[model samples]
Target: MKKILISGMAAFILSLAVPCAVYAEEYMDGRTENGTALSVQAMAVTEDIHRVVDVLKTGRMDEGSAGDASFWQLGAGTFSMSRNIMEAAQAQAPAGARLSSYTQDDLYILAHVICGEAQSYPDDEQLYVGSVVLNRVSHPSFPDSVSAVVFQRGQYACTWDGNYYREPTPQNWANARYLLEHGSVLPGNVVWQSGGRQGSGVYIRTRYHCYCY
Candidate 1:
């Protein structure tokens, strides 16, 4: 454990230091036999690249994988340094604990919770709801199984309000199966959600809930 922590910290620190190139240029100058002056050209290639990077960073980049990080330093001010560090950490990270251990019962439980929470929403949002449950099952802070995360007391209101017992729609079942097969449309760390923004960890929002880490 100590070795792993040290390695991770070392990797994180080293990766964070991978600076974004703010400036670059190539110039070649040679005098002709007559020593005539040649045309001067300045492309400002670095500046153009910097400008493009600035714009691209503000938009989404594989947000489904992004959800697990709780928050990303997306401010253009930080630039690619943070992006590289995140990639490093994810590369070494362990798979969600016991996520592959889920059974048929867990699938039904997931479908029921989706039915209770997001059945009326679009098909994707319904899958997002199911994804939240699976993300929790794999996260270190929560229980490690679908049924455990869904019924883990006060975590999901539907489990208590009798809504979870409803027969799930066909779409809900499909969403549940898709989650177990293809994984979340959300990130792996987004376990908390509410009607409005809840915390500093905000990731995305749907019609009925704000999902966050």
Candidate 2:
């Protein structure tokens, strides 16, 4: 009887230790193995919008919309989507490469950094525009919502030009989505044209300010 009790306790301890050992090994392996390479999907129109709405709801909204409502009608929805994108990007980033570290002003700065890297317009434009639009919505001067900011007359250049601001092509949208998800601000203090003639192109100020034509 004594032997059986001792053996049972040993087995129980061993069982517990085995799982703990496995967990420790997995964590150590993850650290040594270069964390899983994330195959982040490009932001599709539907997917991106959905992500934005989820974030906005977490931050400021109560409940989202019911069906295919008007853009303005789904203001909180838009904010939620942008917020979701930022949060997800922050999650996959390496240490110190998070969008959340930046303030709204910092986000404005990062938007320029992202735009500078863009190789396409409109869809690529939307990434920056979407970021900016979220800023405005969250800011005091704007309507306090993503859809509101985008639909506001004369607010976004693309909207005014009838660009439709639809889903980006696969490649361009992928690049934009990646930047939105993973781009970070390097250490520096510089300003590039957010918009203008030179501003018409994307601008970056790292290693001195430059624009992508």
| Model 2 / residue 152 / CA error / Å | 1.1
lDDT of 2 by residue, 1-213 (tens): 733543354344334333333222322224433222211211222343454345344443333463323433343443443344344434443231223332444433333323433324555343443344334544455564434545567644444554443433465445434444554232111112243424223322223223221
The per-model lDDT (C-alpha) reads 0.59, 0.37
Candidate 2, which segments miss by more than 4 Å at Cα? 1-127, 165-167, 171-194, 197-213
Distance from true position, residue 106, model 1, in Å?
Answer: 1.1
lDDT of 1 by residue, 1-213 (tens): 733543354344333332212101111112232111111111222333333344345543345556323223332323344444344334432333225556799888989999988877789789778877888877778887788889898888898888888888898998888888777777666677788755444555556787765
Error of 2 at 189 (Å): 14
Candidate 1 yields a Cα-based lDDT of: 0.59
RMSD of each: 19.6, 23.1
